[model samples]
Target chain A: MAYEQSVYLTGDHELVEEFGLLCYQAGYRVTGTAHPGPVRRKLPVFFRKSTLVPRSATVAMELTNVRTDLKRKNLKFLDGALPKGALLLSSSVTVAAHEQASWIAHPERLIGIAALPTFGGRKLIEMAPAPQTGKDALARSQAFFTRLNKEVAVIQDRVGMVLPRMVCMVINEACFAAGENVATPADIDTAMKLGTNYPSGPIEWANAIGFHQVTAVLEALYRDLGEERYRIAPLLRHFAGGNRWWET
Target chain B: MGTGIAYAAALASMDALLYDVTAEALERGFGKLRADIRQSVEKGKLSPERSEEILSRIRTTGALADLAPCGAVIEAIVEDLAVKQELFRTLSGICASDAILATNTSSLSVTAIASGVSSPERVVGMHFFNPAHIMKLVEIVEGHQTSPDALAAARGLAEAMGKKPVMAKDTPGFIVNRVARPFYGEALRLLGEGVTTAEEIDRIARLEGNFKMGPFELMDLIGIDINFAVTKSMYEQTFGEPRYRPHIIQQQMVHAGLLGRKTKRGFYSYPP
Candidate 1:
């Protein structure tokens, strides 16, 4: 178990930067950080993954928003020169660990972790490991999270994992219900908070986590599972696409 | 459920006639209600005199006619649609025409329960969460034929009982139960998939998500059998939508008689 003490972090999303900072605060030496600008639209396939980090590092954390394709593209590039014994924890809330790992030759080394926008303030890491993930890799992943003083729930490799999947879908449903005039956003939020004892209403939760990310998780789940249950509410998608429903 | 509703009504200063199938069953309900109010008094949440006063307001009876003079008759019985329909039909015939007939049902359709009654508009759903006297939220669900007056009356009753009432259509699971499905379903599915232990999920939800209780913890407190039944009902009502689908893990737990706190066993074991 020769785990590296230094970690290479990539991606420009706030989640990525915050996660990197969490690792640093947890005492891991972060060697490099990469904020690939708008790579989702250009040079996605031609990028050299090796040039993004020091070759000596044994761990790389890839953090991206719900644009799962970008994570998949990064995994494909890293497949060529993925260091031996190195682990890749991709911050993907929508894509399944198995699906993302499929792009890499060593799927056993890939784990998908749900990085909520509020994750930096918390001490829990929601982990989803690919089916092919080896016991050593799983243990090493757990060790990484433990080092951050974070409790870990290594869930089955599924899209959206547990909390994010459930929460995002809740937000989507609220958006749908609001669109149909079933209830107002405030009413729905209040009903959920008072009715079910949820910590926050779905719409307010979306506001905190960013509506763009909520819609992204739903869209990815719909695309990956092809289920009507995962369909994004048109209202949520509209809001995510620069259409503001409120002053905020 | 009947005892819970009776307790809530008693605490609200409403004289309640608790009717059950037999004298023995009604006595048992009374015993539980007494113990609950006593516990509250012991905890200083309720004064002993007030507990006694609340208890004095409740009268137990096995006769259907005993409920005839009440302004509101809330039925909390078996969850079967047929059973509920028959009961509501009988209550509609026996009670005053203007009296509100509310079903304390979590899953069955309020409209269907009212369909066989004489005036379907008088029937509505007053859904109370478990341990009704403690949980603050009450769902006042409107059936298809439910009159606005009936809805208002039910809401008023909930408010009078010091409960927060949320209006919902007669949709499956109403608002809370329907929206809360994923919380338990996803957690159980993750456990079945061996992605994480139930303890881990529970810990993360409480500590990280700041939930009052973890999914597994709440399920255990609510009773696995009760939760599973709600899931099955929602799935059936939703036409087998994947979201409301019950996990096999929970079904297996229920089958094994691991029905949560009542059974002293569930996702986590409890000391008897």
Candidate 2:
């Protein structure tokens, strides 16, 4: 019998559920645990976490929403718990792959990916490798997404990767336009769709993707790149803080 | 743009005065207008008699004075501020004081064009996308002195012409151009950084994001020269705002004359 490929996904309950389904679609067995709040306030992952990843798990994924969470806690814990030579995929939308690698005991099996929530339907998956990633790990990153039936876009290691930065930047501008009363959300959406052929209105798209991710990426870009252009729009901050431009 | 706007207006059952300085220009506008409406008639979008009626409703002229009788004159002339201001100044003198004056400018400020013209409140922006007869959206922009009455009039006119009008303050690029800049700028930044090839980025944008066209493909469709100019103007008009900064790649591409479809070269190659 062919060996089964199993994945261990850890994150918020909603995100883990969403990713686990994606893994199932790719015909991989998935087990996940709901993270216990933030590491700043909680105990170690092994102490408070109830679900333990099985030894046969070949892929370990951490879907922390922000770069800081992975930097401060998730990477070290995943590095310690996963079996030797198992591939590690960490969400690196706000942090570069290399920086995340610095947190692990063995960074050779670690690679960075931008597999955001609700991305199960996307036909492309973006990946970047840290300096310490082994050749097999890089190959596995490619094969892993290939199993998901997505074309892998391996790009230079950078904060926010490629699509995340571009999409989030556009959404940031839309937030500024909306918050300034430049036009109503509906009209703004109509203009973009009719005028520019955007997939969706930037304002509404941001809301659909959840504003928290947008704000997180912008903050990371600003912090990492140190460029004023990446600075978060004040209006976007408000939206990220438990407000919706419009309901899904 | 003016020809399409006139076609849209005439099809909406309004009499339109198509104005230009040269007789040749006026004739060319009329010929294109006839060709466009003929397609509509052939497509069964309009009856033959209606197309003919719409054709006849558009009267061409070599004199600006002919627009004096128009209830609303929408100028889709060259996008130069001084020239637009002068033209509006002359038209305001010739037309009735209450007549509405609208510009089809997509880049320049509505307030700047309305400046020095008598009754600035009557001046507004009626921005129509390319192929104005087909696109449904129009931005009804209010300049500094634009009045509520003028805005309502433009809004009503846009609706009457079968266009969905959106309101915006007279900011740079209005709504569409300004907010849409990041699509091109960020793509250029990514490509410059060697993050990925244009083809891969475009593919990702289509398959992953569901956009109709990737940023590079869209830029190629809209001439690189034109897109660069819009970006530069937005940056300048925003007083050197960091977010609206024009990418260096755009400047280099324009200098190399690798302008999209028109030149048959851009971010990607076209064999033809």
Candidate 3:
């Protein structure tokens, strides 16, 4: 089937690889792929018989761009490179994609989707629209994920979005409990699983999602809302900075 | 008067000296414990001989001095800080210096209570949930000066009682109370904001959020007065953080003495 929109992706994780492969299979053009450096060569254009193919898709995977300065520069380079109406989808946890949407030729065409590299088997895709994103952009975002056989849940434009937000809050509470020795990590997880039937105890969830990401969400929530309830636990903050209490 | 804590304490084979300011309170507590043991024996939950042995381990006393010889003393007294401090002050002087002085205070600051004692190092908060014998989580709180050995001993004792011990630093509401605040506060805020009714909020939390009980129902069971007191303590301890702020609706309910099932009136009406 012929595709109507071109999608550009940025991220080097498993989600990026899977999403790029899905886009290719779904008849979208793979205009360029960049990891840590600039795409220095022209992208290969696949053509069908007797006519010039309308190359509508431009998917770029920028996963290795970790430094904030380099990331900002790379995003600017991508913004200048994509054709008009090209959709920019970001799957990076460090940089909120919506923040860079305005720099594009069509600001309203950009949407941010939370990406899970490991748990990508689940069909649920959390979609958040940037402040400048229009209705068409939102629909395109939904359709893009839908094409990949993913179900989408739309949420407010906030760091961590919905599931991550709710899950992070639970983890934050659990960390506070663990920090205080309210219960051993094993028992805390056990009580939640046994007593309340949570999918995973907060500590295990933190370990799975990476403590830094959890701490970032908490710190963001605290900073944005200035609420003490969202204050990052000392243990979580310490872990984010690669420190453990037991070592000290 | 509750049978759970006393029965579990007896089952753990710790010599329990149940004390109250009045003899009637002690009698009621002991009677309830005895009835529970008898039922266990009849149901084969405990052998008749073991039931007798369990009963032998618990002694009732009105005098504070009776707690002196005990290796560890858990004060499940009234929640008032002044009263708790006074009791601890008395217990500190009466009990052996080596004995671990523990308060079963769920909401009050363990640090504040420890501060009242000459040997704050010996003071620790051993917060057991209501129906303590049934609830498995025991918060073992360490005050600023609480010795590592003291904390370890408290943890060991909690395990000895077959309770899961979680370490918590001395903070308002400690872990459970502090972390669990939003469960009630957000529900009340939803009520005040007119986002949802009390019944609907409770229903959503149970059905959607997967809480066993809604905030309002749990508040009623815990008593409006007690819940309000905990919220106020957390707010005050956090220097009046807005997130932990107490709602006026709860304060009004307490003023009305609609303290849930105990008073037969709260968020819902109950028949006595």
On DockQ, the candidate that comes out on top is 2
Predicted candidate 3 versus true structure: per-residue lDDT over A61-124, tens digit per residue: 3432234455566566665665666566654344555665655566676666655433344546
Query: What's model 2's lDDT at B141?
Result: 96
Which of the two candidates, 1 or 3, achieves a greater TM-score against the reference? 1
TM-score for predicted model 2 compared with the true structure: 0.92
Task: Calculate DockQ per candidate and list them.
Answer: 0.36, 0.67, 0.13
Cα lDDT tens digits, model 1, B1-272, are 88888888888898888999988988988998888888888899999899889999888888898888989999899888899999999998999989999999888899999998999999999988878888888888899999999999999999999998878888887777776777887778668767578888888787778788999999999899989998998899979988778888889998899998999998889996
Give per-model TM-scores.
0.81, 0.92, 0.64
Span of 10 residues, lowest total lDDT, candidate 1 chain A: A38-47
The order of the candidates by TM-score, greatest first, is 2, 1, 3
Interface Cα RMSD per model, in Å? 2.3, 1.1, 5.4
* Better lDDT candidate (1, 2): 2
DockQ, cand. 1 = 0.36
lDDT per residue as tens, model 2, A79-156: 888888889998888788898898878989888887555564688878889888899999978888888788888877
- Per-residue lDDT value at B209 in model 3: 42
Q: Give the per-residue lDDT of model 2 (tens digit) for B1-272.
A: 89999888887888888989889988888888788778888999889998889888888888888788888999999999999999999999988877899999999999999999978999999999999988999999999999999999999999999999999989998899988998888888888888888988898788778888899999999999999999999999989998889888989989999999889999888888
**lDDT, candidate 1, A1-248, per-residue tens:** 34356676665455655676676666555644344432233222212233555676567787766566676676776655557888888876767777777778888888888887776568677887778778888899998888888877766676676678767877877787777655567767877887778999888998888787787787777776677777778889887876777543
Candidate lDDT scores, in order, read 0.79, 0.83, 0.67
Candidate 3 deviation (Cα RMSD)? 7.7
What is the CA-based DockQ of model 2? Answer: 0.67
